[model samples]
Target: MMYKHFRHGDLLKQWAEQAEARIAPRIREIEKRVEFHQWRLLEAYRQTGVSEQHLSSSTGYGYDDMGREALEEIVARVFGAEAALLRPHITSGTHAIAACLFGVLRPGEELLYITGPPYDTLTQVIGEEQDGTGSLADYGIGYQAVDLTPEGKVDWPAVQKAIRPQTRCIAIQRSRGYSERASFSVEAIGEMVEKVRRLCPDAIVFVDNCYGEFVEDQEPSHVGADLIAGSLIKNPGGGLAKSGGYIVGRKKWVDRAASRLIAPGILAEGGATYGYLRDFYQGFFLAPHVVGEALKGALFASAVLEAAGFETTPRYDEPRTDLIQLIRLQDPKRLIAFCQGIQAASPVDARFLPEPSPMPGYEDPVIMAAGTFVQGASIELSADGPLRPPYLAYLQGGLTAAHVKIGVLTALDRMLTHSPSESAKLER
Candidate 1:
């Protein structure tokens, strides 16, 4: 019973009922809509196709530059942002975030991670707590985190207390894809941002929107957030993007981020003009349907896993527009194996894989990859080991129903085989 929480079962049920109540209409329509659009996206993938513009491909930058420019134009118009940037060269979400963070925050000002202590790769980019030696620490800017509520809502009171005169900007994750429990709601974040605006009118509100884009009926910016950052390799990729991330919102932040794109006199539009163009186009084309499917996988995963006698965060069938699903294993070993099992079930080669290691070189080495059909986005069926007091395996996204079913089935099957004791304990 994914719904069973032992002592918290009733509480979980109450929460689920409330969530269902909130999104009843939308959830009701998603299933059929998602199925229809999925077939269309798969057909599109078979056509125009995708490639990393910045990678070591035989097709150089000049190869299809004109076609690429048209795509960027389409992307700029899709989201109501002043400008957009894209890159197939970058491999991960953190790299894109770093490009935006260091580009926007100055050396003298403090940057508050209002919603998070941040994803693991952040330590390398901004420095770590032990010595505070990352970008912010080494560069003289301060770093602070405002923990979320027990339900995973932003602690507004804490945010009020944490902001200082020197606080340059406040950062939070738009989707709690990485969260063990409560994901911050879009409406809640907007309300909180309005509060922050009242406190420090000058401070910027930045959102790291990894798994939340396209899935939400409303975006962080719709709530007046200064900037929203995330990559295309997830939901925004439309199950079609080969690779990329983006930062969109106000002009000041957009231009500043553009200024940070390296090479001194070099232009920012070089890589982005194409990669972003392609990913953005593909994203919208497949977004509604694909994300809906991913949500279904998350829903099914939560329900089935809970039924199998495990404690799941966000309790399956709980109100979630995003695709993330978390199952607590408690034991680190089981957590690692759980992640490994998810990876093994990926469409790509499973043999050349590494165990669910902490993201090497960073404090949190939890391994995860996007499970897509065409080396597609990982929003569906990607799993990672979380570093915490009690380890957990955080899973999210499924581009197709089949992908979701296969990946999740593989994960549960492995749990039954290698981690039977853990499964038995959950059921007990």
Candidate 2:
């Protein structure tokens, strides 16, 4: 109490005394909470170890064969799907969404993506201007995306207005992968889905459920999504899975969606059977722990960067409802440097990209972000190219508190080295 009144060295004794008085009792509960999850995760890890054994020895069936089956079970059980299909053949979360779109929405029919300003890939996949023969337009699919506003949210009126009679599906990309501002909560999305259903019950509601799986035990599937999509090696797999794609919900939609997998039959590329039985299992096992750790990373990144006089989105430790954290640097060069700073801390990275340069195929020059997810974009990392103006950079992902702290430190250190006083000035 005296320490509260005066500022001096003996204050340390009073501070320690008060801290013990305040925290001693809480320690047991905190330890129990932490240990309970830790042990559960350890058990999950053990399960993963066993699964790895089976995964390696299992042959003739090959990687795809085992992975798809495991994933199907994981999706059904973990995500609460009526029927689930896992395809190791599909590339990423976006690929899974496209498959669902192509499978459910017929060519010449209208399809609406309610999630505005989704990943850049969505534009390419749905637009006719780029990606040559790959656009949804090439296949005769009429696609429209309703972008969010300056408040970083969907234009609900616009979403309602965009619906057409031919609309087969309304896609809601729940991924905050590229966005630093905000994302839809499962309940919020559920509200939107319910409203959309009121408008058109037949139209499927598809959510890009990446960076979203297992962050909370109950996912959108629980809230009644027609279909939810994500990648295996991301949050679901807990940094343990090698590869796979997920599409779950609405049995009819899933059944129809499978048709697009491996060309409709004969399991062309390892035959579209819920085949990969193991990776899916491992993914579920690691998801809880990995997600918790990833949240910790996000919080820590927010803490450090915000302390460094940099602006951070999601506000860090206050209350994280999601996995990724965005540290916004309005300067484009600072964004690149931030990305490079994070890479310096990654165990797997040898080099990091921090510049917006042209690539072989991309229409715009994007400053590439590398997150060492086994299949890419797990509870991984990201750095987005700015849309315009101040050109903010987004830094996100840390599967563990330690990793998040180190990554943030490395970024801050790198940033310090490039300050105006410090020489090695970044290209503005």
**Top-scoring candidate (TM-score):** 2
Task: Provide backbone clash counts, one per model.
Answer: 20, 15
Off by over 4 Å in 2: 1-71, 129-132, 266-279, 317-319, 351-354, 359-363, 369-377, 381-388, 421-428
Give the per-residue lDDT digits (tens) of candidate 1, residues 1-428: 54342233454344445444544455566676565555544554434343454222223433446445444333444445555555566566776787678777887788888776776557667674436455667777778888877767677788889888889888877656555656667787788788888988998888887787655556677778777777777887767776767777776776677567543334353443433454456565677677887886676666656665668877754566466677877776667666666777787766545464555545555656444464536665677765665787778778775566556655655665676566555445
Query: What TM value does model 1 have?
Result: 0.78
Candidate 2 lDDT over 1-428, as tens digits, reads: 33332222242333234333443343344334445545655553454344554443234534355444544554565566787766566678778877887778777787787777567666666776434576778778887878777787678888878888888888887757565557668878878888889888888888888777755546787888888887776776666566777788877777767787645653323453333545556556656666666665565566555545667767643434466666667766677777777766676663645567775334556675565756355466544555444556665555675676556656666665667542223211
Evaluated at residue 1, the lDDT of candidate 2 is: 38
Best by lDDT: 1
Q: Which consecutive 10 residues in model 2 have the weakest lDDT in total?
A: 2-11
- Each candidate structure's TM-score, on Cα atoms with residue i matched to residue i, is 0.78, 0.79
Please give the lDDT score at residue 329 for candidate 1. 71
